[model samples]
Target chain A: MVDRHLFGLGLRKPHYGAFLDGAEPVPVDFVEVISENFMVEGGRPLDVLRRVRARHPVALHGVSMSIGSADGIDVDYLRRLRALVDAVEPLFVSDHLSWSRIGGFNAHDLLPLPYTGDALAVVCANIDRAQEALGRTMLVENPSSYIHLPGEMPEWEFLDMICRRTGCALLLDVNNIIVSASNHGFDATAYLAGIPAARVRQIHLAGHSQGRALLIDTHDRPVPPSVWSLYAAALERFGPVATMIERDDDIPPLAELLDELALARDIASDRERRAA
Target chain B: MTLRALQHGFRDWLTSESGPLAGRYPAGLAVYLNTYRAQLMACLSDSYPMLVAWLGEAAFAAAAATHIDGSPPHGWTLDAYALDFPVTLDGLYPEDPEVAELARLECGLGLAFVGPDAAAVDPSRLGNVDWEAAALHLAPTFRLLPATTNAAAIWSALAAGERPPPAERLPQAASIAIWRQGFTPLFRTLEAEEGEALALIRAGHGFGALCAALVERLGEEHGPARAGAFLGRWLGDGLIVDVN
Candidate 1:
């Protein structure tokens, strides 16, 4: 098991050097890496992951599991991912709750799925296969959305049902919850309330791009205040779940991101006091 | 629709310019389409920077959009997503073979950067080889590419942030060789003689057979000498994995 509470940053290429070198005691407890990037057989990518893993606990966050595809999971992909897990020995593995590939063609984007019973079964089955193959319980993060189908169940209910059926944990991205609420016309707080707090094992906080009529989870900017508000609410319900700040584009210096991570630490620090 | 049908529908929309969502165009549909194009274009541009540098954004983007639609990523890693983009570039400018060559060189560099690791062949161990039966194993990251145009020169200049040299076809057939040396990607033009030998070596030829082919080109007196010289260069470049 991980610590009682931990704060981290999504490890990116731009910050690779600063992270490996002794650049004076960085503040993050653990680092999360995009698993597919380090699924290589051998190279600088795997080397760097090993060096960082020596210092901090690593969480393997994946983007291409396509866990909701009714066609079933890819065995080769699972093998490679399992190989990486053996090498890195990460604390736990995670991927988005959305599907990425279809018909053997990887769209390379996290596409939205309709919240239905059939979709739930597909996702839950895939999760069971993944967990069994990985030899551990996996966390599934909620994805930001662009569209949805009619006659579907609520998003929170879908997430909650996935956990109940598969015995998998959730990696709730507070910003995704906020972005989906804005795009699908649902209340964010109610979305939070619907989730079983005990099942949420981690939280993701990131920035978004506001288009003319929709919000995009771009993950390029600093954490905005609205997302922070949602995060505080998440802390209230799921106290001290492993928190991480993810920045993929326009990445600033490590110091700038450390400041944001500090803010997450402060907010999570208050959850216990507030509950008391 | 079934979950499978819904996913296929989503894919159809992602690859189509006519919008993927049904009914009234929600602003969110535009959001998805715009991000899809922008993100895929970025991946293609990163894969073939020199080609985009030479073709400029407007032209590259037009071809890239087509490539994205026709050749959706078959691999999980986006780094591997644009592997076949040079085919699109080749079709776009069939008259200019250099366009495809440039893309090949760029793609080769990316592959070499992430390919499997191997120990460089030891020069001290070179002399113990039985030439009659020894086969040289090339590094996994090593790539040998035939070139007719000055694509290597153009790729080099663009990679260095300099204006490309004048584009012209070479008088003789040339080749580009790339391999990673201690985690850094390195590429250079291979000599005509060495380039021919590389092709034979990659085709699983033994040392004695490689020398015989060199003898066919360089005569008996200098055949063994020339093959030895090329072997030395490959060893120094860390391109040889082992001798078996």
Candidate 2:
């Protein structure tokens, strides 16, 4: 049965001033930030974050941690991220189980990591170092994949092993699961079943674009019905996780996002009611 | 392949045509290359809007492709990626000073918009201080730029949704002053005298030296007055943060 669940929306720059204006009431539990956006020394972004934090809980979701890079995490990047963490006091901080930078050059995409044993060990070590440096455990989100490498293990096993080894929590993005499952020919339900229920701390729901060969995890559209179904399965497995809708590009109005978030809330609430 | 090799292969494939996507994952490879290109190009466009206006979308994208090839982003944040793009554009169009100047103006705006917030300079406390002993501190967001073309006007017009004036080069060397005033970032051309004085101040020149320099430029009678006028302007512009 679902116990306690929270709904949130990913905060983007376009809606910053609106969120601060306080004219309309938003119906989400907290706002998740891209983390790097507010990693400035002092500016309007930080000021807005401070004002927003005063109003709602914040979750620092980062894109550039590169936690799976074999070259290791950038020390200065970690210190700056930690500084932002100290300042924001987010409910929790998280990044993908993918790497962005390699060999001193950063591609800035949530680039895939081969799900090999060595890659798993590297990411787990990096996560451990990151948590130690930040003085707190961080949740690692499962990223949408485009291709499966030759010799890598299953994505779910990679996630399970990383969380188990590093003591990190799972973000368990359901949309990513559906997107990857469609792209790589796997069952989204089986992917969820492989994950340990107690380890999930949050759930990310978003939309994907249908490509000719694969589904692209572009968080531009509303959550599709198929992803919503997978999210229900996730809720059944990892009950009552903190859930948020993530939209990065072609952002709709705050009201539109709130409506999508309400659907997630309704789905979860119904699941809970049925259990009751 | 090892994770390191796979990632290295990923980066190589992204920046080049015939890199490591040779035997595997061609479908996914195109998606990532498209993403990296789109992301970095959007950042450059944001930082250099006037360049886009001058060079249309297709031409701008082509030129930006060269810049992107020359300098991949090395920072954690894309905010700072366009910092060196003006130079890259300068090299791309050495004969067209307007390109680099417009990129510089746009980049300056981005910097001023995100730079540290500071308390506005207090003008009333100027009376009790000794002029020569006080070294003025410039605001954290304040920047001085030497302009070669009417790029500032182009940027201003683009900002105000008006048609650009003309792309003319200046006969005399002029500098543009950019800083964040309240929440708005602004830039304006500086008179030679004001620019010189700001240069001296930026170089840690004291008030006495500034006054003497103004005296040498103007007559003795109007020199200190002009210096005080500059002081008033700096304070009013929120350009100075401290006096030491």
List pairs with backbone clashes in candidate 2: B132-B208
Task: State the fraction of real interface contacts model 2 keeps.
Answer: 0.66
For candidate 2 chain B, which ten residues in a row score worst on lDDT?
A: B15-24
Residue A73 CA displacement from its true place in model 2, Å: 1.5
TM-score (C-alpha) between model 2 and the true structure: 0.96
lDDT of 1 by residue, A1-276 (tens): 344778889898888877899765466888999998888867788889889998889999999898988778889899999999988888779998888787877777777788898999899999999999999899998898977666378888888989999999989999998888898889999999999899888889999988877888999899999999999988888876789999999999989999998898888778777777
Residue B8 deviation, candidate 2, in Å? 1.3
lDDT of 2 by residue, A1-276 (tens): 125899998888778877777776466788899898888867677888898888889999999999988889989889999999998888889999888887778888899877888898899889999999899989999999887776567888888888788888889888899988888898888888899788898999999998878899999899999989988888887788889999998999988998898898999999999889
DockQ for all models: 0.67, 0.70
Candidate 1 wrongly placed segments (more than 4 Å): A1-3, B17-20
Model 2 ranges off by over 4 Å: A1-3, B216-219
Residue pairs clashing, model 1: none
| Model 1 per-residue lDDT at B86 | 86
Clashes of each: 0, 1
